[model samples]
Target: MSAVLSPGMGAIEQAALRSDRFRLEREGDWKRLDAIVTRIEKGRAKGLPDEDLLALPGLYRAVASSLSIARETSLDAATLAYLEALVQRAWFQVYGPRSSLGEWLAGFIGGGWSAAVRAIWIDLLVALAVMVAGTVVGWLLVAHDVEWYQALVPGGLGETRVPGASAAVLRETLFGHTEEQGMSVFAAYLFSHNAQIAILAFALGFAFGLPSLMLLVQNTATLGALLWLFADKGLLIDLCGWLSVHGTTELFAILLAGAAGLHIGRGIAFPGDRPVLESAALAGRHAATVMAGVVLMLVIAGLLEGFARQLIDQTAGRFIVGGFMLAFWLAYFFAYRGRRQTAGGHFA
Candidate 1:
């Protein structure tokens, strides 16, 4: 004869039966997902067929649904635990990052940085205009009043680079004697100074980019003041040649930094339909990538400033080097088409 059961015991028995039935119905898909995920995790998925690889996502979603159902229906403890584990493992294989560090770096250099730069084209244009205007403003200020030179040029250059220095003195400063041993130190110092400026420009982007634009204007204005001083002595072309060696790279880096800041500022200032914080975060990610590349540009500029500018004394040679670099950077950022493209069919 069958034994009698209490009410609680009867309920438990019915639940266990339902859990067993549920597992049986879905266990095949669960097992398939588990096998695929396992193969990938174990580095044995290279030979996995296209069909199986394609099926993996579908299988994962089905198992995830099963897990959710089990929890809601109060399935047996063992079944619940098993589905939880399976779903978690499948989630990683289905959605986790698959690239190694080397792969990531290669992609970033090949296309990611350039794509990010293109994404903020509007901001870049604004920054370029601001820089050009600033330089002109600087020249006009010094041209109108010679006394403005002292205020615009930094104090370190006052001894030799004042407004009224003789042509001999100004020429000597350009083709000055150099200590080979001090070249590295000088390069390091330039790098440090440029890096500081770049960092400040990027960091100040949160205040709607006003501060970043001001910083750019301030830096370029100094450049304008120096240009006027050289132009006054009829050495405008000579000064251009002298600065071309490294100024191309250095100025480009600053331009990008200012643009990155402006991108963030624009995001916050005009968030559109998205929440302000979310829009800022998206812009920040793009800006951060651009800034990372800017650091590399600054390092190159430093090397050119410290060594190439010193070693290449001829005006023509300096322009050649500088022009080649500028061409290279332009092609790399805007011309190269890589394997990965964003939604708009541009490299990313």
Candidate 2:
């Protein structure tokens, strides 16, 4: 061997070069070993500590074993190549672990709640404004001609209907299913509606919670109008019994979905210390979890709407079911959630 003067030569580089030759000579797989070793040396130069380097020997061994197995098993060339790539990726991920689920959930809920609360206040104001506007418009409609108003609201001055004869028949047809049949064809309607509501709620977040708030108000007003109609027509008690069976759960889910939309909107409006993009991402995850819970609630509501509500026509039975659903929601949100906290202090 002849010594050649090179200004670029360094102690660590020389050591790495020697290490590479030794590894190749011992392993007799210079091509692959050299490439992996070169990458590790570069990482070390970039401040990767010794612990990471020491950890790599095990990773290399594992990859070697996996490749040997693949060869022995006669795996297809493409598959074996993919497995090799996966081994490298898994090695880095395992060594440099990232955030855990609990951490992610905490960040999501913490940031999401802050954002949601701000947006919710604006949403409430918007809702009140819309209700005032609607009231004015409704008053005008009624004032224009009492006879026309009477036509629109068949129950007249204060009458309303719930689970109208046709709606009840449809509910019966949709919900009446044997356990052996397992959800039947009508179950599709329930699932699809729940999915549709969730997607709409999520998509409307782009509108800054305005759309969601409007949707909630529109639905609430319709319910209010119906109730007023029923009361006018001496059917208030009957309508209450008809609605209470599934309305408690169904309405709660819709409201929660609206809340999620509001959360996303707030994240966009006020990012606090975080970048808007990051805040939005965090909000999205929390909203997703909340939306999932809403979907479940909707499923339960659908079941009650289809089967239990129809089966129990008694006013007392409907009241009990509705009361229980309301209690459950209040306890979960106001009681349990209120008791939790963040890293800094108690939750709001």
Candidate 3:
């Protein structure tokens, strides 16, 4: 052998001998060691920021057991050092602060919703126009149908149709219907229902929230048609008074739901810079937050729809209740924005 080879032979031989001995020592506990390695590898692959810290207990226990086994077999120091390195590498991976799959998914959902909102503002304007047109068409159609029926059916059936009921009477009926339930019951029902609507709004993004939008448009149109009919009959003031009790709040909740649907739809339609799938995922997160706000609105709306509207028959009382609800919504959303700005400015 060369002079260089001869000089390193003693150290190299010692390491080789230790490695062989360690292998023999590990054989009895090979399965446990394999399991530990597998877990460490899996944690590393997950790329979650705190995975290493979370895996430390398991890794340490495995190392301690292996060390005990090595000691029992009188394994060399070099072999112990090699094993320590392996464990350390695993430790580094598990405790690192890399983002996980879940965080990525959350980002996608959030981004998608924001994009959708921007896309749908135009559609909302179109929908509002459709609502106005539909209202006029529906009222006219209902009126014509009523007239035709009266001409054909004659007497007693006409009484049931009642073409000229007072707006005050309708307002009283609206209030009476609302009073059938208590505040707590109304609140709970609204909360649950609103949650359902919001979730549905988000989930319906599967169909691109199209069905949800259609539902909103149709609803708005129906309301407008009814209002127009009442107005034409010279009961507009009375009808407005009756509707002020609950319609204002309830209608606003529906509008929010429509906005949420629009948000989801736009996300699917226009993912922007990212891949469509990723963008949609990001939008979903933001949509969910907005939907949460929507639920709060709906809960308040339900209170107006049920207890308050029913309990207060007077038009002035209805307006007062409705005005308060509107103010609360504005304060929570618009007012909260200012607070955020102030905090951000201070931090800056």
Candidate 4:
């Protein structure tokens, strides 16, 4: 027996047939685009033939156009949905700004960080001068009165590293016994401690920078007091050697942190023609980039402090390692030109 459809039923059937025909005509391009997008997403794009790679943009545009037509012509739900997904995927493959993690890291190390640092040269100079002043202030305060040592040095170090801890005892602290197994733990602790200082220095910048400046001074004053202690005991050179191993990187990291904070403070304090918040936001972005690099610097410092400083017994050797690191940083930040610089003399 043959069945006959009513007029309404016939119209619905005709629509279904049109939708199927539409999908059949465009499904090939859609599938090809899907395959290409899949390969790229899975990191297999390098294996794709040159022709397929070259045709990606065209395929994307075609799929996008099909999606538009599908939406306007009120096509079947399945065809519309498939076109939407394919177009979206092809759109990303064609015009997305997505980059792999390794590529991002490479770009950052190559020029992004150094450029940000260079952008804040003025802040760096200001921070350096302030730090030097802080060290001197610390030294002078302690020199005028031995009691100031107690105030400047943290209580944790005060137990053994006081004003008159005796030459032998103080010297021992500089060249203490080390267990290889414990070095890792010690390094982690040092990283955590220094990171706190660096981050605090940066985070405090939101308060118009006064707190940040004071923090910088206070921290360095502790260094100055320690320097005086060792110097008075006639172990100044030895102490210098001990510190140089990790101090170069550690101090540089702190310096950047302090500079970053100062930049934000300065922006807020002196917004020029821009609104205070706008200026601060700009400064924050620039400083944030510097701070990101500072974290990496701190990691290196931790390794040096925990391992290199412990393993290398010679004062000269420590200085050599420290000096090399300092020189490397200097060149990378100021002299190295890995990419073209922008109008502001920043790497782009």
Candidate 5:
């Protein structure tokens, strides 16, 4: 064995001293993390105490930092290998494959989706801004020149916006007599249409988000044109009451779908510290959860549009129903997220 080196020695001696001190200070933490990871690898994370689980993420991060320093300093071969292997194991524990379907599903409904939504509040705000701009532009243009109504809205969907449909015709169209199947068919059709729009908005986000933005603009433009028509007939308030019965939830669902798309687009544009592919993959996970919840919103909206519009017929009742549902969503995504544990029960 070499003689003990004095303080302030040569460069090699200094590096050796630092490596030794580093191990001495952190070996205990590494061992504890290794043990926890071993238990998790054996599928025993459920058996870990809450305190132990809570400590895992911090320990894992510390180890990662150590690994980075070790690599940068060109530590001894054995030290470097050990640190690398340890970090890999801990990483698998902290961010690896999920445990089971039932576990994930339970987590999702409990708070996972809401938490995901809250995380993207900024994106959602942007989507709402874009949508509102489109709506405002559409309302102003069609209100200024009625001919622009057909130019903005699609021909098939603009049956309610013919050149000279009187107030009574448009009013009947709102609370109108139906074809063979009544509200059931109408509800189903609305759900299908909205689902298609929402899914398309989400799917098109990968095209750098432009397509999703355009789609939103088109949808809101049609909405604005219709609003102008209803207003012209001296039924603006009544038309709002009719739409409020379901439009709040329906439009909000589409907005979330658009946000999901924008997230993917942003991941592509700005990956930050992560690789572009990895960033996009992470965004996909969160966006998928939001889209899943959006489907539920669409269903609720469809039911309200079909039944509430037909049965209630009163503006206050419509607003009350829509407002209550909107309040519930607001609370679900914003109010309850902070207090819940994410997946792995604090293991993350």
Candidate 6:
């Protein structure tokens, strides 16, 4: 025979009954929600039927409420954990970001890169002007005094043609020096050297873009002086053929990078209506994409200068390759982009 329980004991017994009743009332819904949430995780909600999908947010809210009530009522640990886990998964499905990596990549390729280039067109034009001016000055200086060749061109790059070299010597260097060892060494060095300049031009824009401007001038000046050297040797056509293969892309890549740096500098130096920091941050976001593309261009330039220049010794062939690449880039950026933006707008 059992002893008689006191009123407080009876109240404790009833509270336990109430907690059990709460779990019993909600257990089925919790399990169903868990199943749907699991399916969502696996299938990304694609397999979920309409009703089941519609019910998810409701179920999520129900589970959240249940979790709160369980904590307040001091429910069993197992039941609380079950509800907590369910709610977590459901919350993510309902409220977290909805984009996938594939979607973002597709969007970026579709219009993001080109759109960014178009946005900074003015800065790019200015950068191009600066480079052209530098080239002209370099050409004039070298033409006036051949000694300036020693000052403008690096010792390594100058190894092929020098201050007092004859036309015969430059011809030998240009058309005859396709020997394996010399060509290999020169190509490797040239690619590595230009890559450094390309990266530096963009990186140095922080010094009020002045440093980048100077670098552009120096690079262009060097080209001009080299042109004069080849022209003096009566090998201007040959030199043009050699450079045409990769110079178009390489020069454009460097200018784009310089433009990126300028964009950042302008933002910081003149934030206009916004705060300096915020203006800079926004400009950086846009310029960074252009810089990334510029790096890609440099890599292509390096490859053309390396293997193509080595194998295709004909000047005509080099020009053809360069022309094709320029045409492709122009069409990709303008033609394709313009088709989408009609007189009003339309895709061709």
What residue runs in model 4 are displaced by over 4 Å at the alpha carbon?
Answer: 1-97, 176-180, 184-190, 340-348
The C-alpha lDDT values of all candidates are 0.84, 0.57, 0.55, 0.83, 0.81, 0.78
The per-residue C-alpha lDDT of model 1 at residue 284 equals 97
Instruction: Give the Cα RMSD of candidate 5.
Output: 8.6
Winner on lDDT between 1 and 5 is 1
Q: Write the per-residue lDDT of candidate 5 for residues 1-348, one digit (tens) a residue.
A: 534557769988878877887788789888989899899889787788989889999999998998898899877788889989989988877888555767666677778888889878878998999899989888999989999988877655536556478998877766643342436554566667767879999999998878888888888887888788888888788778778878889998999999999888888888899999999999888898899999888888887777776776577887788788788888888887533335554412
Model 3 agreement with the true structure over 1-348: per-residue lDDT tens digits:
212234447876765666676666564444444455566467543343365445556755676677666667667776677566655654544444334556534432334323333434554464446445655655665566655323332242223224566666544444455436565443355445545644565466556667766655445444555565567666676567666666566655555566666666777788788888887777665556556555655666666665676677677877787777667654544343221111111110
Clashing pairs in 6: 342-345
Error of 5 at 186 (Å): 5.2
What tens digits encode model 4's per-residue C-alpha lDDT throughout 1-348?
A: 323445767777867766777787888988888999999889787799999988998989888998999899898898888888878777776776565667667667888789889989998998888888898899889989999998888665536778768999988777754556435544565567668889999999888877778878888888898889899999999988988988889989988999999999999999999999899999998999899999999888988888888888778988899999999999999998576333222235
In candidate 4, what residue range of length 10 has the lowest lDDT sum? 339-348
TM-score of each: 0.77, 0.53, 0.53, 0.70, 0.70, 0.69
Which candidate number would show the highest TM-score if scored against the true structure? 1
Q: Per-residue lDDT tens digits of candidate 1, residues 1-348?
A: 433444767787877767777877888998888888888888887679999988988998899899899989989898889889988888877776567667777778878888888889899999999999999999999999989888877764547778779988899877754545435544465567667777898899999999999999988888899999998998888889888899899999999999999899999999999999999999998999899999999889988888888888889999999999999888988897565533222234
Point to the candidate with the largest lDDT. 1
RMSD of 1: 5.8
**Model 4 Cα RMSD, Å?**
8.5
lDDT string, candidate 6, 1-348, tens digits: 423445667776766666678877888888889999898788656667899988888989988999999999888787888788889888888886445666544555566557677777877888999999999999999999988988889877746578678888787665654555433666677777777777888788777778888889998899899999888877899988888788878887888888888888888888999999998888887788788778788888888877777677788988898888888776765556532221111122
lDDT of 5 at 154: 62
Worst 10 residues of 2 by lDDT: 154-163
Winner of 2 and 3 under lDDT: 2
Q: What lDDT tens digits, residue by residue, belong to model 2 across residues 229-296? A: 44554556766776777777876676667777877888888889999999988877667666766767
- Candidate with the larger lDDT of 2 and 6: 6
